[model samples]
Target: MTPLLEIALLNIRPGQTEEFEAAFAQAQPLISGMKGYVRHELRRCLEDDHRYALLVWWETLEDHTVGFRGSAQYQEWRALLHHFYDPFPTVEHFVGVLP
Candidate 1:
């Protein structure tokens, strides 16, 4: 099966970019240590410093929805990073449709 890609469009509260990034760095290990984690990347938007795009690869959709989200680590992840957002981010999953 093709790997799954999880995407999140994160918009941090104004003036909190640096603090959010620091929190995210601390939260990274929580997600990366999960069972189906393959890899991930976080990028800041060029035009909007408060915005970010996060891409996380998993072995399967369940690996993220079930394995990761259902784990206690997720709580820690949330506590560490969730408050930085002005509004909650939306998360979606995708799979490769072509080579």
Candidate 2:
């Protein structure tokens, strides 16, 4: 069973939306190529500043923990994106309870 992961990011600068989107677009291929990865949904709060969210579905936590973290793609992801973030991103994992 795939687990749903919800990630919220507090963007850094005000006018960085385009840059952030571009970075994520570049990183999408790396993220999607991981083992056990199912899908990803990205969102932005129009009323908020620099607040973005990602809802991801994975086959297991190990996919993210072992597959993603241990892969070179993560390093590339970080290299392409980690700096544009403001205070950094807060990521959380959740298990399915209902539905």
User: Which numbered prediction scores highest in TM-score against the true structure?
Assistant: 1
TM-score of each candidate structure, all chains considered together: 0.97, 0.88
List ranges where model 2 is wrong by over 4 Å: none
Model 1 regions more than 4 Å off: none
On a 0 to 100 scale, what is the lDDT of residue 95 in model 1? 90
lDDT (C-alpha) at residue 23 in model 1: 95
Error of 2 at 84 (Å): 1.5
* Residue lDDT tens for model 1, 2-98: 7789999999999999999999999999999999899999999999999999999999999999999899999999999999987999999999999
Assess each prediction's global lDDT (C-alpha) against the native: 0.94, 0.81
1-99: candidate 2 lDDT, tens digit per residue = 647675656565778888988988999999998898888988888878587777778888888878887999999988987887777878878987888
Clashing residue pair totals per candidate (backbone < 3 A) = 0, 0
Candidate 1 — worst ten consecutive residues by lDDT sum?
1-10
